[model samples]
Target: YKSGQKCVKVIVPENASIDVYGSGWVCNSGFKKSSTSCVPMTPQEIQKQKELEKALAAEIQRRRAQGVSGDDCETEYKTNAEVCVEITGGDLDCNESYGGDYYRDCDATLRYEVSTDYSGGAYLDVDVECSIEIEYKGRETYSTQTDSSSQDESHSLYAHGSDSETMNFNFSFSSYKEITSVKISSAQCEIDSVDLY
Candidate 1:
């Protein structure tokens, strides 16, 4: 009897013995354990468990090599990575809205809206009033620079309509600027595979 079994009675088929008080249960040395019992793990099942553990370890190493943490695997992720594209310049001519606010930054005052449109589609339709600034060097910016010659301008951007019954849409800015991606988790609407520029 082993200590882990804690003095419990040993239960086994005739001529078979289970080590008592052990950290793990196993038949004593020289004892042949019978199969067909659902209480014990079969040899094939044990092998399968080892294989799964090995695969999971390999996956973790692979993710580490790619600089991806376990947290990044979430499909509908929230927080800093959840953000819309950058608003370079001009007004967005959005035809309709389904009630959503697209911000230029994660926590910035600059934002656009998706107007209400019950029309089903492959993409979520929304109206955007994008704002842009004219800088002294003629480059547009979202933030105000100290350059006295800089001026602000805004325009409306309208995306194409769709009836694909999926929350997907394509939008691009007037001026070329890098845009950060976003993930929106809505109780009423489910946005998927959206590409906003």
Candidate 2:
């Protein structure tokens, strides 16, 4: 009996001699000794740990590429409405609304409507009046008009009765290489809507 020694004893047959060295204890099959306990590391468990470490490394690299620091990362995204709206309307119409002239070759129609409501009498006719100016683009080879002359070229519309009246005007010029813009001036009436194709 060895006292005050942390040694393990094994009893074999009486005639058998056992060899014991000082290089720790021998572990049984499928087990390993770690400190005072026998632990095992399965192949599946080792593979899972490696995969987790790889995934963590990949995530860290991704965040680093986006200039993220610490534990927080920022990302930007465009809204669906903005993305959809951009697909339809593109570029601003550069034609001056009140100053310059616009030219169009296609059959362009400027429609004007005036409506009035009389509060005092049901049979009374309310009078409404308005005006609009259509400017046509000129050729570079020809001389352009001054501001005063350009105002003279604008088309005007006048209305009498209040109920409702529609006026259509057509001007013939060189086919419009491009559609510019249309300007409206309203008095005693509101502009309902405008359309250009």
Candidate 3:
């Protein structure tokens, strides 16, 4: 029962699924799935994963300092090629409204911005998107700063249904090469001035 609810640690066999509610096994997210058995990621893949974990941990700390719960709870992974974040602790009254029950839920990451570099030449030459779950009230707006007096708004997304929803914004931005500071604002909350290495 504890394992099913993800409330306890239980050993699971190989070639199994952790995302499965009661499949009696658990494993990392990045794996090449075949018809029967599961294949682990290569050495290069493991190194990539470690780097990702460090990046994610840094972001999680920043978000948590902003009073966002679930830094230790909510997580995201791939269901295929899409980035999906896990959502938990919804208002029991609003479960039907959210279309989920028990275990974990996956919300597909929205590719909000995917274009050229921002003006002023200080911004990173890459693309970014809103990877957080918007399950609360108000809206999530995407903006970038090129200069002190100006801001860029490319996308505006709204969170419907529950009010006290918890999620993380993918704020580790810029070129992914040398990110100094990151900031993201949603209708319900704002994570400001997060540091990135």
Maximum-TM-score candidate? 3
For candidate 3, write residues 122-196 as lDDT tens digits. 222111122332232112324333211112222211221111222222222222222222222222222112111
Residue 101, candidate 2: C-alpha displacement in angstroms = 17
For model 1 the TM-score comes to 0.21
Against the hidden true structure, what lDDT does model 2 obtain? 0.29
In angstroms, how far off is 72's CA in candidate 2?
59
What does candidate 2's lDDT look like per residue over 1-197, in tens digits?
34367655654333233323332233343443333344554687456545644664675577558763323111112211100000000111122212234443222222223222212221222222223334433544343221111111111122212222332233334443333432221111233221111
User: Which stretches of model 2 miss by more than 4 angstroms?
Assistant: 1-117, 141-165, 174-197
**Cα RMSD to the true fold for all candidates:** 28.8, 40.4, 21.1
What is the overall TM-score of model 3 with all chains considered together?
0.28
Query: What is the TM-score of each predicted model, taking all chains together?
Result: 0.21, 0.23, 0.28
Residue lDDT tens for model 1, 1-197: 45565765445554444432332233333332234112344577456546644664675477558774321121212221221222111111111111222222221112222222222233332222222222211124454321111112222222332211111222332323323232221112222222222
**Model 1: runs farther than 4 Å from truth?**
1-38, 71-197
Order of the predicted models by TM-score, top scorer first: 3, 2, 1
RMSD of 1: 28.8
Which window of ten consecutive residues has the lowest lDDT sum in model 2?
A: 82-91
